[model samples]
Target: MTRAARPGAAATRPGFVWALPAAVFFLMFALTPLLLVVVLSFTSWDGIGEPRFNGLDNWTALLHDPVMIQSVWTTLLLTALGVVTQTPVSILLGVWAAGHQRNRAVLSAVYFVPLLLSATAVSVVWRAVLDPNFGVPAQLTWLFGDGNLLGSKGGAIGVLTFVGVWQFTPLHALIYQGGARAIPQVLYQAAAVDGAGRVRQFLHVTLPQLRNTIITSVILMVVGGLTTFDTVLILTQGGPGTDTTVTAYYMYQKAFKGFDFGVGSAIALVLVVVATLISLAVVRLSGYDRMRGTAEGL
Candidate 1:
């Protein structure tokens, strides 16, 4: 009797026609621009004229520009803050909500309200709410003295961080909530039999079970921080100074305001490289590609 073909081979068989539309879309929109940017980064183009080959001039300028350096630092700081503050808080919120069945729906809705609004809307609303003359700042004058958060370097940074955390935390919490729900109830019972208190059970069973979810959250946080633009643009517009001007903002200024497409492309390319490297490092450190069980091993 003839052996039937394996499912794996059948599944892996080329389906070029089925994939054609997606392949075409990727090539036209994604791959084309990426290739264009790499080519443009080596040319001196002012967005209007023909691009003239400029070698390493743009790269050298990017390396030495003080404002560029500051923006890069700010971007890194923002990403770091998101990773530090958002991911764990999201998990904690998820755990709290999961344990409290009655309030879960209400709590989830409240947390997710910010996400329902467009980024532009959130920025506008927050701008008004944080206005020094008439908003929360006015009420908190005793704490902040001048209460002009968007008008100061450190305050602007803090405001951006707050906005980032507020907007994304709910989404991350949802991710964690799903992961938490998937965990076998038996694990908690086993831990309880071993005298594991709530905290101990969380540290041992819940967290370990959510290892993949946590790593995924971290990646989203980092990437979100890197690409954060509309909030800063609408709220602060890169600041009273350059303090809130992230690498993305700086790249925009170079490309649009400065009309230097070459340098702007270089900055974009640099950010792409940095983000990719950082993501890979996070995955490697978390051992995300290794064995699937046990957070300790990861």
Candidate 2:
């Protein structure tokens, strides 16, 4: 009997034609709206009439607006805090969860439950829990003061950051878990032979091996942090006098609440530019765009 023939690479490889539909969809939905928003930024619109040409007006207003400036700083502050808090936690949890132990597998399933909930649901649940009159804070007045987490600037910001860490860490943890598993076991054995203990092995071998994964996770965190809206809306409504107002929420307030679509579009464009530039810079600096590092061998 003749041996079965293997499929050729030419046959297995997908061509660009197969991706045309997705490309078209992205162009229609993503690029088209973005282009419209860019144009809208240079025009005055209130969602009632046609956009009127008003070059530099929106930009000038946004640049001089104190609230806009505060929102940018607030955005950066939240994003930075998220990165600092979530990255280490995700890495540690991911490494631990990557183990083949059955107990760990069970715990990992439980740990990732938060990621399954919608942001809206999570916010609603937490909002109730933090309610000053009816929630846990009410019962524990001695500890939580008035339990009005959404009332003050510091309290609202704290709740937002905490919710972010709780809800998003699982996702980054899963990313790191996959990266940890992809690391070659031989490297660990070699470290062991060289008298490296668990801590040293993890630091010298595991961390270096997970550089690309770390970068990927960090980029995702930065983007998510920048675009945070639903949580803020449901939790604080940008209240406490704009203390918790992020750029994304500010854009919504301008476009929808205040009926200033021009400034809102400008804010939206700025957000897109900021996120793109930061992500691109990170990719360039980390050499990740070239697909370098631990992925080479496997």
User: Which prediction has the highest TM-score against the true structure?
Assistant: 1
Residue 232's lDDT within candidate 1 is 83
lDDT of 1 by residue, 140-162 (tens): 88887788788888899898889
lDDT values, one for every candidate: 0.88, 0.94
Q: Which digits, one per residue and each the tens of the lDDT, describe model 2 over residues 205-257?
A: 99999999999999999999999999999999888999989999999999999
C-alpha TM-score for every candidate: 0.92, 0.91
Leading candidate by lDDT:
2
- Give me the displacement of residue 97 in model 1, in angstroms: 2.5
TM-score of 2: 0.91
Clashes of 1: 0
